[model samples]
Target: MPDSPYVAMGPRVAIRHTERNDRAEFTRLSRTSAALHHPWLTAPSTDEAFDIFMTKLERDDHEGFLVCLPETGAIAGFINVNSIVRGAFQGGTIGYGAFAPHAGHGYVSEGLGLVLAYAFGPLGLHRIEVNIQPGNEASLALVKRYGFRLEGFSPDYLYIEGAWRDHERYAITSDMFEAQG
Candidate 1:
């Protein structure tokens, strides 16, 4: 296992960079969580696909993080910062999933808060966005809990699960966080 840096830490969970050794557990979680992720998202469930996923994370514009229990280091979920734009924009789109066993336990929510801090602080990112299909209430609630406000709607915004899907755009900026504080 490579040395993984912890992006943020909480009492019960820690958000850390995804390591190559996470393959087996991540695949198992992905396979088991199929029911929960159906139509909404899909995670890599095989070694080959996971390898490809990791390759993408190694790119400059992407980052992958694992949300893990502090004691056992078991993965509770994952979050990806995608298409990071620096320069004047200083933003990124976020994608996340909670493993079935950990769903509804608030791990993903807590972990995401850590991701937000890391993104807005050390990463120097000004804004982060999450695009959710309107029907995915769980996803919408999660972002809303983190103080992401609805920006607008996008028709056929992303191709997912073999078809174009409409999405509601939600976003939060560092300025918003400061205002909340």
Candidate 2:
């Protein structure tokens, strides 16, 4: 457990489900992050990536949103709640990235609170998980701020930046949020 600079910082933020009209801006930001963090993804043409992103946006069972700064109308970050499973589990995995310029501003932290509320409150999801690369200290800290518990480490969990990387799994349950509330 390393100390986190984002333990408590930044002005609060709000997020809204990404709309069809937001596709162009979302695509630009996501692509920029991918280029910086996972250059191998650069080969995909914008249209090709837009199609893939639209698929995520169109799913009813899943959610994708952009974190917006009220004053500037800037998109600080984006989050996705995907692979939702119901029945005995009733869980989903969360994925997110901050716009390059917004990194380290605690924007994602505030946006995370909103995501958790939506996940546990409106979405009726019982549990949400986040998988972070071992080296992504910022993301790990962001998830921790929302009370996600370290579950385990997985090898070859995901392929990004042209190579497979290990991931640290963290999970939070609706019960925990309810108790905290």
Candidate 3:
């Protein structure tokens, strides 16, 4: 939390499901944050792409959340838990990104913390996994602060920027998160 000056100032944010009406703002922010995201992430930046993205979230395996400042209702960032599993394995992988205006302010951390709480509580998840490109120092630090442990590395684990990219895997279970909190 000390990593963000805004965190010290007591930033208050709310997390909610991403809605279809958010299309305009979501794509706008995605386009604006292109510089911050390129090589490290890819987000829907067009009407068609967003339509497709929204469709994917309709599935039981996927859920998306937008983090916003309650006072103004402006979106700070978004997180999506994908590939959720039930029954024996109750968990999912998370992918998140911050908008340019909110990137360094720690809204991402707040949003992530809230989402993880939801996952472990209402979602009844046993664990969650996060995958980060090795060069993405910001992402790595974000996860580390949340008590996620480095599990391993995978070569060409994800395709980004038109090429296969390596990723460092990190994971945290309900027990781990609760212990740290």
Candidate 4:
């Protein structure tokens, strides 16, 4: 068997491409993060959710990484770059969430930094965007701290929990990434 090409964050914490062996932990993490949403989390089942998550993992249009804690071998969070648009626009959107236990410790921020590096450095993605609900103060604060510029407000941009939620669009380009240094 060839070695896994996934990224590592720490002895216990890693940002790795999803693997079949990770299904159970990823399912647990998904269900946990879903609970934190204001609207409540909804999914068919852990197995079904795993299938959906794996579908994203297998696609070239997106990249998904699971944040795992080696001590317990549990998934603590997840990050992904989705809806990649190439050609003159080599960019993608960022989506992520942290499990309840992993929240408030800057885990997501660290994960975001690594994911952004992968997007801009390894993936050659020129721009990355985040669409977050205006009411999600935690998420808003996170993107702001990362120097993402507020682009605009998008109404009914995503369906979360159940209802169509409005989102505030934020973006960071490779130039912005360089400027930050």
lDDT of 2 by residue, 30-92 (tens): 666765555222312276676777687688768886787866678888778988888888899
Q: Provide the TM-score for each candidate, comma-separated.
A: 0.94, 0.84, 0.93, 0.87
lDDT of 1 by residue, 29-103 (tens): 999998999888989999998999999998989889999997888899999999999999999999999998999
**Comparing candidate 1 with candidate 3, which one achieves the higher TM-score?**
1
lDDT of 4 by residue, 42-69 (tens): 4323886778767876889899877666
Candidate 3 C-alpha lDDT tens digits along 92-141 = 99999999888898998988998898888878999999999999999999
Clashing pairs in 4: none
Model 2 segments beyond 4 Å from truth? 1-11, 34-45
Q: Clashing residue pairs, candidate 2?
A: none
In model 1, the Cα lDDT at residue 124 comes to: 91
Whole-model lDDT, model 2: 0.75
lDDT ranking, best first: 1, 3, 4, 2
Rank by TM-score, highest first: 1, 3, 4, 2
User: Which is the better candidate, 2 or 4, if ranked by TM-score?
Assistant: 4
CA shift at 127, candidate 2, in angstroms? 0.3
Local accuracy by lDDT, each model: 0.91, 0.75, 0.89, 0.77
Error of 1 at 23 (Å): 1.2
Query: What CA root-mean-square deviation does each model show from the true structure?
Result: 2.2, 7.1, 5.3, 2.7
